[model samples]
Target: MFNVSDGVPAGGEPVAVTFAAVFVALFVAHQVGDHWIQTQHQASHKGDAGWSGRWACVKHVLTYCATAMVSLAGLAAVTGWCPDGVPAVVGMAVSGVSHFVIDRRWPLRWLADRLGKCPDWLERGGGLYALDQSAHIGFLFIAALVMAS
Candidate 1:
């Protein structure tokens, strides 16, 4: 979907600018929300084997979504690119669901196995963390595209 109207990326469209801005804004917010805003309890318990774990993950996702929304608001405040309506809703929905699924931890592990990533590397090395961050950024790009559209 990386279409260009001119010879350059995004073709200098307002929507393209919005997409780039939204992606960067959300990336910054994701870092802040996951690392700084997420609580120790949530981080420790989110992957546990019970409702408590699910609840912890839910709380984390809630706060994460809130952080993202605030970041979008801040973007609007500075650049006047107000994103609303169905596109924004759907974009955030995609983000929230993706975040929740990934934070559960098992889904990623399962996917890694299915993709034939070395289990030892996934567990012992930084591969899983790198995969997790990359996945989040990939989904964020989709969300930003939706919002810009």
Candidate 2:
């Protein structure tokens, strides 16, 4: 939805600026949704195998995805940089599913257990936490690209 004439590539696509703007907007939304909207209960109990934990995690992911989708849509409306129709939906689905899988904490625990050792800095989950956030950001980038596609 960006200005079609400005910085049109040889392929006649929108300028890179539009992509960058969408990426930044989505990233900000991700930070707010993951950190602010997520409840402590969902954070604490999501890894459990029980139904309550599963539901908590599901609820968290739903809100998180909604936040990202809304932010992306708003950005599109503001900047006139909307991508193809399916990309936004595909991006959100991928982002949300990946977020859910990573936040479940099973992979982190598996890595920790298999590593068989941890330095002091890595002891209190700094390592896993960083990895988790990194993965989320990576997914967000992909989602942004999909949305800008």
Candidate 3:
């Protein structure tokens, strides 16, 4: 039988570095993908007016930065450099799931309807992008913790 525990030592610098690098790479990739999507959306929309486009751009940039920070914190905890593991994992997972759901334009559309508002393209796009970025960060954090352990 191939035991997962056998692959890792109790704790080590190698695991820490690997975990950090992987998490960071995943975050950066998400940001890049988000930016690409936004650019495409802009091109397709062409001459749409109002603050919606600008808001979407700003929201994505800010969300990406926040996600990166959260991922880093989770990575730090997983490396044993920080004293918390479960909380970090939980936080990352929550953030990740929220991101995924939001990006897919799920419950948000329903909520907006309840408030008597239609779902705009910007709202849908921004939610989907944010959710995806969050999911990536969460998955990377979980992977790092498991591998480090």
RMSD for all candidates, in order, please.
4.3, 3.5, 11.1
Candidate 2: segments with Cα more than 4 A from true spot: 1-15, 111-120
State the lDDT of candidate 2 residue by residue for 1-149, as single tens digits.
Answer: 33344456433545566567767887888898989999999889888887887888899999998888788778767755556667767878878888888888887667656877364545575877777788889988887777666
In model 1, the worst 10-residue window by lDDT is 1-10
Error of 3 at 93 (Å): 0.7
lDDT score of residue 123 within candidate 3: 63
Which pairs clash in model 2?
1-80, 1-82, 2-80
Best by TM-score: 1
| Tens digit of per-residue lDDT, candidate 3, span 22-109 | 4564456456545653456543332233466445544554555465555565655664444235644554454445543444343545
Task: Give lDDT: candidate 2, residue 20.
Answer: 79
lDDT of each: 0.85, 0.77, 0.49
lDDT, residue 115, candidate 2:
78
Superposition error at 63 for model 1 (Å): 0.6
TM-score of 3: 0.34
Predicted structure 1: lDDT: 0.85
Tens digits of per-residue lDDT for model 1, 1-149: 22345644343445667788889988998999999999999998888878999999999999999999999889878766656678899999989899988888999988999999997889899888988888898999999989877
TM-score (all chains, Cα) for each model: 0.89, 0.81, 0.34
By lDDT, the better pick of 1 and 2 is 1
